[model samples]
Target: MTSHAATPTDAEAIPNLNTRNVALDRVRTFLTLVVLLHHAVIPYTYFGQTDAKSWIGFDAIILATDSFFMAMFFFLSGLFVWPSLADKEAEKFLRDRLLRLALPFALAALTVIPIAYFAIALRRSPGTTFAVFWWKTITVGPWPSGPVWFAWVLLAFDLTASVLYRVSPNLVDPINRLSLRGCGRPTDFFIFLLVMTAMLYIPMRIYFGPGRWFEFGPFSVQASRVLLYPAYFMIGVGVGAANLHRGLLSMDGRLAKNSWVWAVAALAPYCLLWALIFVKRGMLENPVWLPAWYEASYGFFFSAFSAATLFAILGYFLRFKRSGRSMLDRMQAEAYGMFLVHYPIVLWLQYWLFDFEMPAIAKATVVFVLTVVSSWAVTGILRKIPGAARVL
Candidate 1:
């Protein structure tokens, strides 16, 4: 068996993740925080939250910020995976990633499946009551929401990669200038991105159909979300392995160097995206544009805007240099656990605080803040347990 070798720079030593890579750690922490933010803002969108004086206004497409986590998490996960994997032979790499992704996934699913059983039980009425809902939930009932599907899909992807590795490891590898010795150009990479995206999404929409617009909980189209979101992850892999960090770094003091400038210039595109989305949403609801092609196109354009805007935001923020690797370290330690566990915590708090008289926006804001603080706190607490650190 040919053992995998490390990246040439480290000469095969895995950097103690805890000691190094503050930026990456912070990215994980930040993404986790935003994910909670995204989920917490639900319920108000669809369920129409109750407030102090009880004003009920609905949320629009901006609720799609949830996918921003989709984008970030996949990208960051891909960022670390490539270098880490290169150190091992494909067989060992598959085994390692499987254990890392699959164990947590199975444990999380099994653990939460029961809790979801109970939660759905709590929400139901007597006729088709607690036992009925619980049975369905444990079997096929609702309540397995946010972060739930990620584990399942990630495991599936890992398994797929394993099969592909055995058959054609080179075909499975992300196309990269660094690995290919600089053969692929930027235009080629962009086309690769577009092709992967088109392959994943266009077919996904055809097969799975447009996902139900969920304002709360964690249900998504299981059909192909498993494969689709990984496109972004693979794109990130190409970017990182192609060694584009210097180019990203040197893009300083440009128009994009200031976030506000991006904001202003992006205003027109943002408005156009919103307008098109509104038209699409209106048409979709009216039954005129609810077909597969329309749904697929809708997801495509919105994502295009999201990606463009994300680039602008990252381009601006990356120029920033922050002090205090220490804060990042502490947050980073708690991050993975926080990401895995925070949704329920946030939901439970939302339920407990439901009786409190507050505006919907205010309640969402409070939940957002509470979710971050409590998740961070609980992650820290969990890590103090002897065995917890390993899983987290």
Candidate 2:
């Protein structure tokens, strides 16, 4: 839908776009914690149960987090790209992206990922040495990137956006206009996002079957979500193109006021996803190849739940915690570093805890808390090193 340019009143109604958005920083910090929690509880979950103890609650948590967090991270990462591009030369932006994303991704793939997955290898073959395992992982096969995949993928998106900007700076003006309309009617933006993601996601999920990944050494991504992630990223680029505060994300906007509505919207599709899970397990008997209809249904519900959850989380922060000086604010600086470094801490903690006879909840709680504290502490220490802040 077409809309007029942002008026002075619209700009005056919210915080300056040029300034920091405390709420989004907090949201990013919260997502970092979610990443930690997702990994922390994976060992205890029913589906991914690597430990003797398993919990249904963890399965639920995994289902919800897996459906949306990474995509939302891409969206959030894209949010400031337009402004950043405007402020810097294309070459400078690429260089900064390489330093911030590619370098860390390379380092983590070489060191952090190997170390993290070594715990699993150790569990499988107690006699295996880290040196041997690392060699095989690097030279022979199956070099999983772990969470650091986000860094490189975001860098790719950044590169693509830079080229697109060079082609035409107003490439995303339509979405920006849509975002402006979303200030009062967020449902419009939500629907647009839902439809776009579903269009991009469903057919790919049916064709690729969700379990397939495209991998090359440390670079790998889920096949079904490859297009989906870029869509979210571009939408974020659009929203941040201009008049960010005067658009959908305005603190004084209706999206913030109607946070509970999005919560409700998220719940319905989430429940539908669970229902589809039951259908897959019970009726379909977890077939090697799911029916096309089942995959389509699952994909739609997945996309819907993801879109709704994004709004729910963003709205909650924009409405209630926009100005807070909480733990999130304190951890904001270290959060990205924590995300980069937490995987090894989590896996190693889980590995050590594996032999301990504890309930799943207790083990998960211990793993999550220790991982947070350890990662935060480690990131803080690393940031003190000369020149590390630029990369971390």
Candidate 3:
């Protein structure tokens, strides 16, 4: 849920960010923390009701966060791709991506993911050895990437965009033009994104049925929303390709001026999503496969809410783009590292807390606060190692 800079090597430090997007960086950092909060509260949600106590509020949080966070992550990541590709050679770009993305993904898949999943393994088989579980997981069975799946997927998108850039640097010029037109009318972009994502997503959602995943070895992604993320990513590439300061995300633009309206637009579809959930659970009794009409309705609401919230968040941040000295700026450099390393810390904390006799809200709060601090502290230490800052 965070954007990365250039990769570091043993002799180098973190990439020197001479030109920065403070608003986008803050937004990305906020989303990284939101990712932590999402994981922390999942156990208390209805779908992931692993805790002794559950909360309706956490269900709301899960529903909203799950609907948009990962896609927003892809969008944020894609924002910088066009420029990066322009600035660097294809070989250097690919190498930097491999080091920054694939390296962390590979290391985390082998180390952090096993440790995190061990908590679940223990729950399933209390006496299971970590070594045995790790072996079986890597070789014989399902190996969930945890949240680090975003890294690999983003790298793939970057590579794809890179190739497309070579084919035509102006490939997304039309989208950029639309973004320019959308500055005063953000809903135009929202509708375009909604229609595009719904078209790419709804049929797949109905066909794959939401819970299914496409998995190969340590790689996996939600089957239903696979195309949705790419659509968001490409949109980002288009908007960021040219006139970033004058396009839809301009600080002085109408999108920022009308942030409140975007928030309301976001809320309407969010409420509609809840209503559809209600219908599915209450009226239809939560059938395994809902009718096509219900699935289409759910997809429409999902896409609408997602696009609206994205604009709302971006607009709100753009409105405050010149605000001095935000706290999120401090962690912006380390946000990607925090994201990469936080999963096991959070999962372990949840596992330890699962047996405690406490309310879900209190437990989730403690886990979230502690996870942010621990993850931040751990990333700080890791970045201190030579060349670690580059990749982390």
Candidate 4:
């Protein structure tokens, strides 16, 4: 997430060489790669349901990734914000954030997103020109931002946090205290997060319903989960406020010690979610307006699985913090760039592979592998340009 390395405009909170959490860096890189994988296999999943080849296993993966990845990304992105704000003036922080987040988001929204969707647009208008499609997307209608939506949303959160930090530096201190208390008993933190997320998320989800998007041209977010993301981001800020090393994420802390327990916690909710899915499809018959009770129950499972998996991932990464060199290290610097550019690559690859008669597993595997390699290579080349590393 934080990349652990600072640019001229941005500062690293932890200065000591020994204090850097390489595990988090690795986790961030892994999440970026997972983005590629998620998009690659989506065409073969029931949700996307685009390609002829569909896999039940991919449905499972898509369910899990859809539930957790972006939320975890927000959490990780928030980890460094409090510290970064502490070290810079408000004006400088805004400038740095603009450069780091907004510039790339703008470029991708205007360029990369249109190119990716053109493939989809061409399906309906078989002979549409690239120029015509691009113009129509920007000027006339539906300009989907795709994955770059995350970048803009994160920028908004960072800006909001800066304002909150200015109002009261100790606003998140209570959360910091709780994070400290959870060091030797992470179940407490897990329970707290689950309760908080459910309270914020479930009611909105019920009101808005799933599949609703807050779309306005290139900018859009899931209408229901708008509040949910900020809660996770602020919690991240709280956890990293102070005493990061001795907090719940400490290498020797109970969170890391009982990673297996957290994994089980995650699994229980995952199973519950699938059961609900079965009920929806088989018994409930996929009603337009799901019953309030059913929605609430599904929301509970979704929140539980999401919160548990966050802990599970963090705990596992912390447990293996000192496991020597990792493949994640190689792509660490390019993770952000890869995320920004990867949607187009993955979508185009799926489009190209749409006509193939290959099995779902083989197609997904090929698309995912090639997307990772191609995105990684492109990011590597992009970073070589003078000053590109600062933003990418």
Error of 2 at 357 (Å): 0.9
lDDT of 1 by residue, 1-392 (tens): 00000000011114344434334445555555666666666556642342232223434423435334465456555544455455567777666655555666566655644453343235444255545654665465454544655654555554554455457545534564432432222224334554566567666666655553332233333443445567776655544442434322223324225545444544554555456557665765645325676656655654554454445455444445223544545666666777766766666666666667677788777878888888788878877888767656
lDDT string for model 3 (1-392, tens) is 11111111111111336545578778888888888898888888787867778999999998888787777877777776787788888999899989988999899989988888898888779999999999999998778888878777877888899999999999999999999998877778888888999999999888888778888887887888889989998998898887787889888889889888878888988999999899999999999888888888888889888888888888889887547898788987788888888888878888888889999999999989999999999999999999998887
Task: Order candidates by TM-score, high to low.
Answer: 4, 2, 3, 1
Q: What is the lDDT of residue 328 in candidate 1?
A: 46
Who is ahead in TM-score, 1 or 4? 4
| Candidate 4 regions with alpha-carbon error over 4 angstroms | 1-18
Please give the TM-score that candidate 2 achieves against the real structure: 0.95
**If candidate 1 were superposed on the true structure by all CA atoms, what would the RMSD be?**
7.5
Off by over 4 Å in 1: 1-21, 46-64, 89-95, 126-136, 139-145, 162-174, 178-195, 212-221, 224-227, 242-270, 280-285, 321-329
Residue pairs clashing in model 4 are none
Q: Which pairs in model 3 have colliding backbones?
A: 8-390
lDDT of each prediction vs. the true structure? 0.51, 0.85, 0.82, 0.82
